[model samples]
Target chain A: MLRRLIARWQGIVLALIGIVATVWLALTDQLSLYIHPGTSWFAIVMALIGAVLVIAAFALTPLEDDHQVASDASQPGPAVHLHEHDPTAPRSVGSGTIRAALAAAIIVGASLALLVLPPATLTSAAAAQRSINSETSTLDQDATALVGGDTSSFTVKDWAVLLGQSPDADFFAGRSIDLVGFVSSSPDDPDNVFYVTRFVVTHCAIDAQPVGVPVYLPGWAERFEPDQWVTASGAIVPNPGSSSAEPLLLTPDEISVTDQPEQPYVY
Target chain B: MSPPPAPLRPAPPKPSTRPRAAVGLSLGVALVLLFVAIRVLAPEAVGDVLSNSVQDFFTLSISVVIESLPFVFLGILLSIGVQVWLPDGFLLRHLPRNRVARRVTVSLLGVLLPVCECGNVPLARGLILRGLTVGESMTFLLAAPILNPVTIITTYQAFGWSDGILVSRILGGFVIANLIGWIYSRHPSPMSLLTPKFQASCAHAHDEVRASRTRRSVAMFDKETSAMLPALFVGSAVAGLIQVAVSRDVLVTLGQNPVLSVFALMALAFVVAICSNVDAFFILAFGSTFMPGAIVAFLVFGPMIDVKMLALMRTTFTAKTLVQLTVIVGLASAALGLAVNALA
Candidate 1:
């Protein structure tokens, strides 16, 4: 019994250290950046449960003598019986020493890396912000161009920025901006209207979410398939208190089929 | 007999002479104390680092464990129930007799079990002990994470039905699993890697329960769970650390360089060791930058070959076998990815 207990002692100690370290780190707020901000509380709870399970398992394991006898009785072969009581057999000693050293090295290395490395700089975030700001400014200058006047002042980014800033922004409620995305058919609206969809990816394409602006182009139905990526220059118009889908709609001036851009999704 | 002269032999000491349990308990306590002391006495500069690290560790641990709790619990319960309730002859009776038919059936069945890659290890182990052939067990291990309902639903939702990515992932996973299983069956030497001692232990546990008419199976379940859970926690902790510490920029940069990208992602998959349940999301995010084929390779190869899986694999197979399996899975996944890219 004693021998069996000793054999499992190392595992038990390691597990406890792991549990304590995890809990301590979480409670001290170090774990916040990696996990979803919203899920921090839940994470703590689960950690506690996991820790308890681990500790309980460690405590419940049978003593070494009983374990050894049980094992010996179960397997009669010499192969199974060799050095049964030697917990520090050469194979175990070498492997254990190496594994422990490697684990310590990894933990230390990771800690140093995390400490030295800065948080990922959001390169796209800055660009997106700049583009939106620029577009918004242009749209403001082109406010008068909506009355059948030609305006080169407004840029695509400004219009997007304006639309995003106020889905109810008054000027764009009846004006148009150029947009590009894949065609997605709406089941309810069987007219020539389709959603021009693009994915906005943040970190990677994996977390990409679909964003679509509704468009009503006269010949759009015949021009594009559901998955075909296309670009359309259009006029923005407000929907008259219709469905909850989207308040504003687009009226395309010209539609053209386009190839999917590299990095099609943005987070 | 009493008249015979007594030999001058020394009798072996009784088992009571060894203070085994006490020594073990003290050693365990001493190690814990030693670690705690070292943690407490960390240098001031490193103290801040350790504190931050601990916090990060806790947070990541919690998030991952909670995120996976539902699936983990369900998988364990199902596994336990399968062990206790499923008849001994269930697989043998239901599984097809022909090799080809068995392969197909096993592959199809693998899709229905919604276990993450880590969870699949235990399930695979259980299936093997329950008398499933190596080929069937291998097929299940490879296909379970890829073909499960959760992965399918997630994929459908991610890509929609616009292109055939969803169908392609399924078809690709199915074909690859079966092909690997068939090849494995042809050369069954890998099956010998399962240590006889481990098999005997598993069999003994099973036999004990079978011998008892009462609810003694709970004890066996507890024993197995206890044995497996510590390794699981440690392995996962290591994986989490790698995920946080490694930069994606490095991976992306490496991924830009031709064939190196494929090997890089495969290596990254082994290192980052994300759960199979949500790895596809990460893979999709890296689209276009890395070859679609390479990304597919990452997805297929990663779940089966991560650090945690390797650790678990060590428990079952010899070192030689583990290395061979790793190479085989790596090559197979890459080939499949290339094939898909060419055909698509």
Candidate 2:
């Protein structure tokens, strides 16, 4: 029965699991947590189409297919020709059973991962693993465009680019910045400084690149844990400390914990 | 949609089957509702049991799965259309009789169907079921991702003919795909290169089972997903785990060395497993640090093979075949990268 179920119903079960998860994510407005917002429609639409197909498959498929699958599953040789009904054939029952069990395990595992777990944004661990600020393409913007523009709407990625392009303190002398993102410690000065980090996703979380704006706050770890979402308002100042490598850092006038935004990753 | 594969009998499905269909429908609806309920009401703290990195690993893995699931469905739908609806031998009859010309034609099919590599696996399986030779299907599988219109346009948008990145990717992908096709076409028993179960599936696909197109399609969907999704989940998990385990700094530091940079980026490409359509933009962040050749290698090698691609392909190809495919594609991509670097 397990083998038969694995052969005939595993795909439908898995597809349904995926379809339900995707649609729920879409309904909840959290699909962007895993992928770019631009592609959410495509994912949701395809999922709906898949859901219909799964239902249609369930409703329209003849019982013969099920019976054929069961009979085929019972015949146990691994070779392609084993379906040709050779009673004397040596059956590889052990391997076939193992394969079926593995398939069953995959079905269970996929359900638990997709259906049971709460949706999440990538953490500081991902930021550190991909290494903060190592990626430049998504961060490659016209820093010059921000020179005289309103700086209130600038994201951490914008400031990161501006920091890279306009290194002089005068460019940022009077600009006050307000940014919101998860907290991650500066690699150089973990205690005194932490970065306001957001993943810049070009397509999906798989291609996400960590971008952060360093903030100078001594003993910040005592107040805020890594990956804690926070809102910070500050001035961009030249790094005040001698030990840090970053030329510029955000010296915040006010910082407090906040809820993670509806969309955490900046596309 | 076209005529069903076989229409000789065309007998209407019996009324007796309607009750069974009702049962199947209820079962399916019940399963879907159960999944939704589980997703909605499952304890939020269940995920917190895992540490941050572990949670991130699942997030990344789930992300890959969510991103690719739709494409995989689209692929399977297309596969079903190709196998059950399209007229038999319609695709094969038009191809050139000359083997090399046939492969050249096959590789360019991707330009028409722009689904990325993940989608290509099921479509390739469909083509094989529809009587395309395994070699030609292999050619389509490798060539389609890079040769597709979306990938080309994205590459163009990202690089804009700089350092010959766009031109090299297109030409290199074309050459490498045909090279694989040509080599595999000469195999003594090409069927041996496929997994036994997949080979059996091919044989069964040819058996001319008589059923309504709807029935056949659903049946095909069941079989295809059973084969494809397990591999996809496992592949996504491995990809996520590697992303959490490996340090990006180790790879980025090698970006300055022209030779090591090529291998390093290739390794990165293997692990990152981003879709081919957007990878040009993804890698552009590293464009300043890495040589053009390394980027070229990445563009060429990644769509054709990666942790995810390998798992998807493993459904259809044998372990030995995959190993050979990896080594050959790896070497060819490396050589292409090195040659481009030299020219630059």
Best by lDDT: 2
lDDT of 1 by residue, A83-121 (tens): 354342233444435544544544444333332222221
* Per-residue C-alpha lDDT of model 1 across residues B193-283, encoded as one tens digit per residue: 5644354455453544422322333333344443344455556567656655665557767776556677778877887666676676656
All models: lDDT?
0.53, 0.85
Least accurate stretch of 10 residues (summed lDDT) in model 2 chain B? B1-10
Off by over 4 Å in 1: A1-3, A9-267, B1-76, B188-191, B195-197, B203-206, B210-227, B237-246, B254-261
Measured by TM-score, the strongest candidate is 2
**In model 2, which regions exceed 4 Å deviation?**
A62-73, A76-80, A83-91, B1-15
Please give each candidate's TM-score: 0.57, 0.95
TM-score of chain A of each: 0.39, 0.90
